[model samples]
Target: MIANPSDVRNLLESHYFLFAFLSSLGTLQIAVTGSGIRALWLTPYRRVTRWLGFVCIITGVLFFFGQPLFVDGPWAAGSVQADSTTRAWGVASWDELAGARNVNDIHGGLDGVDQAIWFSLAAIIAFSVSVVFGALSIKANTKELRVDAKLDDDDIDGLAGLVHRSYFSNLPISVRNFRLEARKFWRDGVRSADRWSLIKIISGGSNQ
Candidate 1:
């Protein structure tokens, strides 16, 4: 059986709707997933992804623009399309088709929309993958910070000489002597009288 012009129009309309739905899905994913990933990366791939999605949406819109399937018109394909150009801007009549047609008669040709689909598809896919990477990146960062904190604690402990690297024959004796001297420094008898009264207390100011 031969395909009626109306049937052909319907088919195009179906395809346009499907593409529109897919384009919307991709755009949504790019936004949600890319934003999720954005929290982790010092740098995000969003600029490129945004540009790509914009291109896809524009391309899909232009492709279905005032075509027989998308607009309200006498043609069979009219009114079947998803008027998706950020504000219903596309071919809505046969006369508009003249402008949509380009180069060898392609509707969504060279002007960015045609080139924008692949970019959009890739960007959306990349963003989906990035969501997982972001979570892993955060977990790894937390673990690293933990390790750093533990190492710092260990270093501080060592500086206080709680752990000795080597044992010299007289080391313990020296350490004991050092401790004794330190304790003596804190004792009242060890501190010289001249060192006292140098600090003026707020309440003692009048007496001074």
Candidate 2:
């Protein structure tokens, strides 16, 4: 069956970002992952990153507009899709998303596949931002790995953040893989930090 993007969009605005942010670590991952810190703004990938960032921001806005629709279908389509309370904010926004439909009695917006388009547009934006940043972070980590030098303490913090960002970038793309890497990053960070802490404690530093 064709997926209903409207439903998906609603989920995103309602609580998905909270999950995404917690699970993925947002933009910090990208900065830490890339050697582009050397020339981040002018890095070869910077141009692409900026555009994707723009798209990500736009997608967030689009989802804002499309939200009520999923919550409230247009009248022409049927009666209140939502309960009485949601009718206030939801119906108006739903009609607006439907694009100048006779919303007086029309509560529902575009029906069937049309309901999916707005959300799909948002998806395009989501993909660009998350994937672009995620990939860049991965490349940076790989580059560091190739060097085989332990990241300095500050760099380790950066790596921790980068791992989180990579987590987010991976969320929508491959949730399973994202979780795996996230576990690795968190566990590794803890182990590394613990080891350092132990050394410092032996040398008279705080034992944790």
Candidate 3:
């Protein structure tokens, strides 16, 4: 399905593109958590959800600095000049660009560093937008634990149910029956604990 894999590789190698991808994921996590929409959350644990967003932010920033942007002038004939910074570093000829374009007869496409740049500024735009959204998401979630508030209902029953169904929906009927039984047992234990705690509180009050 790929028309030009060389272009894809070059795009993927860009620090800006990596930042944008991670930032987008981070934003999505924050948006879902802050929106208090359990249906959209990736996991049942609010702490895990928040941690995922933070992880994304940290990951994006780390990747953004992994490589510096490379710049070269457009070709006029058989050669093009490198950018001022590049030229200052002693690379001024088009031979570097030509060598990059030389395809391998056996494997095909340019070697790792030779792939040409496409959509030069598009990655930057994506990275900037992702950073903005990630910041906004963090701001929105900072006022309150929106994800926790949403999960407070029946201790994240909805979120847990969603995960359980997604993973085991295709399993045999016997497994499904066992899952229901296990859930019932867990709920019974919770209720027993609550009752015992209430009883202890009344006994203590009576003694006082």
Best by TM-score: 3
**What C-alpha lDDT do the candidate models reach, one value each?**
0.42, 0.42, 0.45
The TM-scores of all predictions, comma-separated, are: 0.29, 0.30, 0.32
Q: TM-score of model 2 relative to the true fold?
A: 0.30
Which portions of model 2 miss their true places by more than 4 Å? 1-44, 66-208
lDDT of 1 at 17: 53
For candidate 3, write residues 1-208 as lDDT tens digits: 2113444235335644456566766666677567554333445545677688779878887654432223321222232233211122212243454433222322233343332232234444544453454344434443444344532333334334322222122123435656787899899987667666866677773332
Predicted candidate 2 versus true structure: per-residue lDDT over 111-135, tens digit per residue: 4454355445544554445556455
Find the 10 residues in a row with the least total lDDT in model 1: 161-170
Name the candidate that leads on lDDT: 3
Candidate 1 structure quality by residue, lDDT tens digits, 1-208: 2224343334444544546544664465356434433322222344654565566666666655544435433232232233222112233466545433232112222335534664566446554444444344434445443454432342232123211111121235456767776788778554554344446344453333
Please estimate how well model 2 matches the true structure, expressed as its whole-model Cα lDDT: 0.42
Q: Model 1 TM-score?
A: 0.29
Model 3 pairs in collision: none
- Selected candidate, larger TM-score, 1 vs 2: 2
Whole-model alpha-carbon lDDT for candidate 1: 0.42
